[model samples]
Target: MSKNYHFIAIGGAVMHNLALALLSKGYQVSGSDDEIYEPSRSRLKAAGILPEEKGWFPDKIHQGLDGIILGMHARIDNPELIRAKALNIPIFSFPAFIYEQSKEKKRVVISGSHGKTTITSMVLHVLKSCGLDFDYLVGAQIEGFDLMVRLSDAPIIIIEGDEYLTSPLDRRPKFFHYHHHILLMSGIAWDHFNVFPTFENYVDQFSQLAAMTPEKGAFIFYEDDPNVKKIAAEVPNTVRKTPYREHPAVIKAGQTYLLTKKGELPISVFGQHNLQNLQGAWEICQNLGITADQFYESIASFKGAAKRQQILAKSDDSILFRDFAHAPSKLKATVEAVKVQYPDRKLIAVQELHTYSSLNKDFVHNYAHTFDAADVAIIYLNPKAVSLKKLELMDESTLRSGFKRNDLILFTETKKLKSYLENQIYQNCNLLLMSSGNYDDMDLTTLQKTINKQHS
Candidate 1:
């Protein structure tokens, strides 16, 4: 019999994909969401799996339903979730369901503070390109891949292993559930302040994830990252440990080309960190018995994960990019990557203090000297964000003092920030805007185009 499943907070990026995958597999699926956005709304509507407009319907939960899959957005008291709980029916978080589905398949989990999506997407792209059928759960909307979640009769499944709690109820790390045959740790740095309060605590989460890999499995890591190295060395087991570093590459005509041991490979994805990600992906595929030639062929067309060093617009002289780099380490790495990628171009690095941790006057010091590569560094934090996230409102003095960049400009209003950016000459310059949230719904794409027009 076909399984009947209901999703709490079905409007989420990963949740919607899971619903679609189940629907494709002929499961009776229903879902609820307070709001819906692009791709999810259209995709759900097309698949005939969308919730009827807006809200949690407790009546939707029933005893006959096989299981309820919950998203992180759904509160513990979510009406639909509460209804499912009362029924004592099987409930599965999305990650839990993935583990349930891929129990027998060889699981390849990509875990780290940053580059999880990129590394996972790379593995998925190569696997698909080589016609090696495999299921996957990646965070971003990857091109060539239609959805974020895929399930099939394939013998393998690769997942972007987020170190955050599995669910509000689970309290376990999301990556802990999967039966990992192959594990890759890109790097570990302090992140998700709400989850792990201290730097050491945040580092320990990766260590725990590493230990979860079976003794027969393989643990792939980026040895360049000291934190990743520290955790990799401690996981004392026969889990065949493989280390990867940045591949040889040269920047030419504003394009980056990688020089593999076999030959020079040109791929659209750039930066030393991304190069490291490619190496990790290649090694994971290699451990899975994929040939070196196959990995390179698939990576040729790979652009990148959405918002991870994604180019917004470009002109001969000016280029603008955006990234989901809110955490201190990610922000620093992203800035450094861009500066290195285009050394001749002046970099104007801008970041929005969107996360609760980043806005915290106490935690703000973590971002110190992160944007030192940029010719001009600007920190944009919305006052409304401070109130919404329930964080202490920081003064310009406090915010500036925390980042410790003396010449940094700070702004609370989009108009003032826009004005400041508009006046800047972008000649031979690159504008990098990093945030995990919209800058108060400011259209950065339009702004990038406007800036490009001025310079053109």
Candidate 2:
């Protein structure tokens, strides 16, 4: 029998994708989001599950419903939730629901402060290339994958585990819900300042995730990160613990080649972080019965997850790249990667302080020296964002002090930032835009066109 599922706050990226996945599986899926945004709205509309009306209706919730999947966007006092609770309908947090569905399958969870999406994407790419059928839940969309979440009868499922809170009502972190048979930890860095006040509290989440692995499960982690190394050492002896560092590779004429016994294999992705991510993925794939040669052949074609070192435009003399790097660790790795990729070219790096952690005056100091790799480093923040986030106004001196780079440039106006970018000489230069959010809604396509036109 096809189960009927209703989602509250269905407009979230993962929630909408999960709804579509269930719909594809012949389940009756209904969803309601007070306000839906582009991409999610359009995709849900295409799936024929877009609610005809916005906001919750208590009438939509009843005892007949098989389940209610709660998204993080919905508050604990949501009307739909209240109705469902009153009716005694089973309500599951997003992660809990996913766990319920994949409990029968072998779960491979990639968890860390950074590189979770990239590592998960890598594993998915290799599995798909090797003709393996598997279900997956990745945080970011990847090339050739139409959806970010998938559920099927496949014996295995790969999950990109996030450390954020599961839902408004469920205080547990999302990764805690996943009972992993194969767990991979890339690294641990303190993030989500609003939820985790101190660095130690944030690090404890990974230790908890490590403990959730079954006795016979495998724990793969990056040994380079001291925190991850410490966690791996403390795991129960019953679980198989494997550690990896950056894959041995050489860069020749701006191309990265993996060093293997077979020979140097060229790959589409670069950077030490990505190499480490690849190593983590390789270990997971190996545990899944994929041969080393087959893994290499498949991984060489992996282009990387969207927004993680994605190229926006390129020309003979100049190029433009964009990354979803808002956290301090991600910011440092991305800047270093682009610089390493084009050593001879000038790197013009622009980052937006949009996340709660990045915008917080108290947390800004963590970003010090992260942009040292960029020849011209620029940080952009809109005052309106600070007001919206309910954070204190951070002055230019505070930002300058936080970065500790005398040459750092700061901008509060999108127009001024755009103007400065437009006026820059692109000859033999690489432009890198880093942000979890858009630069105050700047049209990147238009900016790319303007750069192309100027170069033409």
Candidate 3:
């Protein structure tokens, strides 16, 4: 008989994908969410798993269900959760359930403040190219993959481990549950201030994750990041510790090519950070029995994960790109990457202060000089977001002083920001939209059309 599983708050990015994965695996899947966003909603509707209504139904839970998967969006007092507890049904957090599903396989977990998605996607692409069977759970939708989560009877599973809280009922970090046999630490920067509350608290989670690697397992880290270095040094000698640096590459006429003994090979992605990501992926692939030559050959066609340096439109003189860079370290790396990748073109970088940490007056100071590489820096924060998050209202002076950029342009209204961008001359310039949000629902297609016209 097929196992029956129900998802609470299943409309999330990974939650919906996980639902579809189970359905594909022949499990009887059902789910509910108080709110469902695009792509998730559309995908769930297509799969016939989308909730008929917007809210939860306690009657949906019963003793007949095999298991219950909980998402972080649900509250401790959620009615469905109460019913599940009363019925003594097994409740698994997103990461916990993923760990359960892949327990028999060798788990390669990618953990850090940034670059987890890129590295995971790179490994998946290479594995597919080599015709190796593997399951994966990446944060974003890659260029060629249809879903972000997959579960099968493969020998190995590649998981993008996150440091965020697992669920409302379980306060432990998500990565803590993965129990990785092989661990990769991309880099560490303090984030999720609302949960961790301090830099030391945030770093402690990574330390614990490093300690979780089995004695015979491998722990890979970026050698350059000081935070990663400190964590790597503390891990016991029983675990194999490997370090990776940026791949040797050269940029010619706006294209980045890896310098290999086989010769210079062009790739679809650019930036030093991405090269570092590639190196990390290569190290993991090596452990998985893929040869260096095979890895390089497969990586050449890897465009990138969605919203990680995703190009929206391009012309000879100008290009517009969007990235999900909200943290200070990621913001700085992305800005510098673009500027260094195209030295001749001016960089007009705009980022939205959407995350809870970014909008906090106390955390704002961390962003100091992050946008220094850009020729033009613009910051946007929707005023209603402040109220919605119940944070202290931020003023222009606080943001300017926090970023320490006297000339930074600040906008609170999406309309004004769009108008300001539409009026700019994009000739010989690059426009970078960096945010975890959509600039308060700004339409990208219309903006792309307007900007492409200006560039032409």
Colliding residue pairs in candidate 3: none
Scored against the true structure, residue 266 in model 2 reaches a CA lDDT of 99
Q: Using lDDT as the measure, what is the rank order of every candidate, best first?
A: 3, 2, 1
- TM-scores of the models, in the order given: 0.95, 0.97, 0.98
Best by lDDT: 3
lDDT for each candidate structure: 0.85, 0.91, 0.93
Better of 1 and 2 by lDDT: 2
After superposition, candidate 2 runs with Cα above 4 Å error:
450-456
User: Which ten residues in a row are the worst by lDDT in model 1?
Assistant: 443-452
Full-model lDDT, candidate 1? 0.85
Residue pairs with clashing backbones, model 2: none
- lDDT per residue, candidate 2, 302-365, as tens digits? 9989998887887776779989999999999999998897899999999999989999999999
Best by TM-score: 3
Residues 168-268 of candidate 3 have per-residue lDDT tens digits of 89898999998999999999999999999889999999999999999999999999999899999999999999999999999999999999999999998
- lDDT of residue 420 for candidate 2: 89
- The CA lDDT at 107 in model 3 is 98
Instruction: Return the lDDT, model 2, position 48.
Output: 92
Report model 1's TM-score to 2 decimal places: 0.95
Better-scoring candidate (TM-score), 2 or 3: 3
Order of models, best TM-score first:
3, 2, 1
